[model samples]
Target: MDSSDLAYDVFSRQCSSRSTLEHVTGRWGALTLGALHDGTFRFNELRRRVDGVSEKMLSQTLHALERDGLVLRDAQPTNPPRVDYQLTALGREIAERLLALIHFVEGRQGEVLKAQERYDAARGGL
Candidate 1:
């Protein structure tokens, strides 16, 4: 069977879904998506909410997510030209899943930190 006959496999290096996964899971992308999940926001507002993401990086992330159909950019014609961004339906679904993973990781940080400490100590003598 050829690729068309098979499901989209992210494990395949040539598959396009892998890139989308990166956009949804990367540091800035994940943060941006998660913040947007709460509500729509303008560029600066989103940057503030995401925190620590540089303006350039956030702009690139938004552009990528928008291209992936996971985000909607609403540009209004006004004195200053307001531009707001919100997750698309697909974006919402993706964000929901990402949020679950984020919460899970956050809740387990204590255990993760302990493991990290142990790992560092084990290698300290090396």
Candidate 2:
């Protein structure tokens, strides 16, 4: 099918975009993309910036993003071999949107916590 003729409906279970959406919105995926938004980062740097991601999870997330064409992995031929990750054009577009969402949630965290407290109290939780 032609590119324009392809239909992507994320809500549909059979839609390929659903998988891409999951990767883009997954915990590690979002965090990874957000970190790479500033510039390129080596694996260790990404781990430090992402705070809680395990090495395995980080590696998997990077691989997934690279497969999705949202991340570029550049490996330099050296004695020890160095690799860096950066967001592709498509990745930057999605990362910017994700960052906005993260900012919004962060800004309203206090309010969300208060609402959660109220909800829990109503449900008989401490």
Candidate 3:
């Protein structure tokens, strides 16, 4: 295809903006990336750290990250197999961005709470 044709064809389709946002800002993905920021973690450790993630969801999310080449999964041979997960370079970059987002939320938490309260009061009165 010509360069302009390729550009037009690529731009013709709707981008997966919703899924992309969901992947980055999803509850599990956000928590997982934040946890991995510290260092590598085993499956159980990750499960514990992420608070509300179910075993199945954790597994599925990890699989997605691994498939995207953002997570490095190292499986060790043992009586029971041991798997450790660490962020790939790309993952690390994104994790840093996530960290910044977390910080932003934390800093504005009080303001956000006040805004929510105002909204609730207004809506409830209406």
Candidate 4:
């Protein structure tokens, strides 16, 4: 059954929600959303904020988020043609939750690193 026939089953292979979940949680997607959550930003500004993301990948991520209705793109006609990106209401809500997870990860990074070291030690060091 399709997502509409159900409750947007993320576990279903054919469910569109699966793709949206991936888009939001993917490396670039999550970072991009977090960066945009700070405020609206121009393309280059966002690229700089996201760090390590290539122009092409950032463009694709933005397109996917926009298609999912989680991001808004405002293009202005001007001398240089400014294009800005920001989170929509739905995007903001999702981003808030994502940020909570991110903060939790950050807060536990030391513990996570210690666990990783223990695992690596047990494995005789990778």
Candidate closest to the true structure, highest lDDT: 2
Model 1: per-residue Cα lDDT over 20-119, one tens digit each: 9999999999999999999999999999998899999999999999999999999999988999999999999999999999999999999999998899
Clashes of 3: 0
- TM-score against truth, every candidate: 0.93, 0.96, 0.83, 0.94
Computed on alpha carbons, the lDDT of every model, listed in order, comes to: 0.95, 0.96, 0.84, 0.95
Q: Encode model 3's per-residue lDDT on 1-126: one tens digit a residue.
A: 654344222233454434544565788888898899899999999999999899999998888777766789999998799999999998899889999999999999999999989998989943
Best by TM-score: 2
**Native-referenced Cα lDDT, model 4:** 0.95
What is residue 19's positional error in candidate 4, in angstroms? 0.4
Q: Tens digits of per-residue lDDT for model 4 on 1-126?
A: 764577767998988799999999999999999999999999999999999999999999999999999999999999889999999999999999999999999999999999999999999997
Q: How accurate locally is residue 15 in candidate 1, as Cα lDDT from 0 to 100?
A: 88
RMSD of 1: 2.6
Residue-pair clashes, model 4: 0
Q: Stretches of candidate 3 above 4 Å error?
A: 1-21
Stronger candidate by TM-score (2 vs 4): 2
Q: Give the TM-score ranking, best first.
A: 2, 4, 1, 3
Question: Candidate 2: where are CA atoms >4 Å away?
Answer: none
Q: After superposition, how far is residue 15 of candidate 2 from its true place, in Å?
A: 0.7
